[model samples]
Target: MVNIRRIGLVATLCASVLSLPAYAQQYRFNYSKLYTQMKNNLEEGHPDVKVAFFFQEHKTSRLCKIDKAWMEKDKHYEEFVIPPSQELIVPLDDNLRQVGPLVYVNAEQGKTCDFSMVVMTKQPLSGEVSYQDIEQLLPQMSKMLDDLGGMFSSWFAPKVIGLTFEFDGVKQSAIQTSKGNTFSIDNGKAKVNLADLSKNESLLLPQTTFRVLPLLEK
Candidate 1:
């Protein structure tokens, strides 16, 4: 009787494990697809702008720069630079496969390069997703994931906690949001809480340039 109960319990556990949702496993970072979307968006949205995409180590206090050696290593580009002049598409190699790189959109001197950025991450959130402002968009984002699956969902599936924008070209950075609120990027970087920009749905606008740093789980 006891042996029979043990076997039954093992069978039940196996069933439960097998019944788990496969959606989570399906979620992935497809760099080619992501780059295509970003490229097309930038081309159609802002024809005069050029952008660079790279991963910045969070713990590094100093500014991040793309290394020439790494960029040219193995004939595989680690950093991607997209120019509006031509259709430039560089494939992401295995080294930075699943990492979400920071995007730098450039603007002509004294001009603002306005654009929208999608936050993507595969890591789990560090804490609870309780931001009331972003909470409202959860349902819509979920629907997007269901419809688009991993192709585009990676852009919006992650929970955004804090946002950081860094501007390097000009000394004084005048950053503005879609809500009309303005902020300055000190020392080429400015950290902003998502709660503060509740009314804004997008980041990056004219008269300044910046890089995006979205808070992720430690």
Candidate 2:
């Protein structure tokens, strides 16, 4: 006969393990060397441009009501900025980026504030670089990976969800899933693809900058 208590125990363990966050996986990559390569690429191409990195903080009005008077008095927004910096490692999953210096805000009440990184250039890129441009750059990134040897890939294959580029304050973004190399871009203003760009692990900055976001308690 099957032991009911043992089956229950097994079920509980499986549920607990499944509930953990996907970002909990220790996704390690060569942050330092990647940063160096990114810096070099930007300097050689856009010499005058600066890059800024930031994540959005989203909070709901119901949560704000806990401190209604104070939130109202402060005139906070539901969405706000967590600026960029060289030290920032762009989180593979947007939600996982919320390691904070959180601030309270009152923007977009009653809705969840979805946070994601915004990679911006101080000045617009000289011209639009499309998938073809990225394709050309692939060899450069592949070469960098090759130099790292097989050890890098043997451990894990890095996955990139997406990347957003801002040109003269206009936004263009691309998204990809773990299943394939195809990606979709928004606004159609930029022709870049995340799959091609993700190949270059070293592309990390143009002169990356950062800002801190505020926290709200529920």
Candidate 3:
């Protein structure tokens, strides 16, 4: 009799679980489409750009040469590389963040090399992000961007031009851009003409999460 009652309870719980709304499930970020767009843009814009890969130690800004031994040991963890360019895309996690694919620009005689740093959350984010989560991720993304900037050689003259955030909601009017700044969101993507956020670290609420692709120029 007890076994029969327990089985009935389990079935009831299973039915309730299945009836939950779709939003309750994990939200998916379309990384592939964005990656394809990034590659295409790089190819069209940076026809002369050169790219190389280097292994960077954890928590260190200096990038080391990739040796054959490291390859054999599978120590070379590649996050993402935009072809024909040495730009990197970082998976931004509050707990487990991996930074890599450090940009190595070999500019031609009189030209300059430019690229962007992409910071994205590792896991699928909810439709709504709490204030606390945004607060926490703000510092993490800022530091990661600064850390990447530090890896650049002084001669490159790295400058932050602008940044874009790709997510599933619009927070345009709610967000206050600086003077002469306008926020635009079309099909779940928004852009900010701001940079070096490490300097200011101002908060943009309700973005939930982002793949922070910042255009760096010479």
Q: Which candidate number has the best TM-score? A: 1
Compute the lDDT of residue 143 as modeled in candidate 3. Answer: 41
Q: Where does candidate 3 stray beyond 4 Å?
A: 1-117, 151-164, 167-184, 191-218
The RMSD (Cα, Å) of candidate 2 is 16.9
Ranking by TM-score: 1, 3, 2
Error of 3 at 182 (Å): 14
What does the lDDT read for residue 213 in candidate 3?
39
lDDT of 1 by residue, 6-80 (tens): 000000111101111321111112353445334432323222222323322234433223221112224444444
- How far is each candidate from the true structure, as Cα RMSD in Å? 17.9, 16.9, 22.6
Error of 3 at 158 (Å): 11
TM-score of 3: 0.27
Best by lDDT: 1
Judging by TM-score, tell me the better candidate of 1 and 2: 1
lDDT of 3: 0.31
| After superposition, candidate 2 runs with Cα above 4 Å error | 1-102, 118-123, 126-218
Expressed as tens digits, the lDDT of each residue in 136-206 for candidate 2 is 43333333222222345423423222233322223344333233333333333223334544432322222
List the lowest-lDDT window of 10 residues for candidate 3.
Answer: 6-15
The reply for model 1, stretches above 4 Å from the true place, is 1-60, 64-67, 70-90, 93-159, 171-182, 198-208, 216-218
Superposition error at 12 for model 3 (Å)? 56
Q: TM-score for every candidate vs. truth? A: 0.31, 0.24, 0.27
Best of the two (2, 3) by TM-score: 3
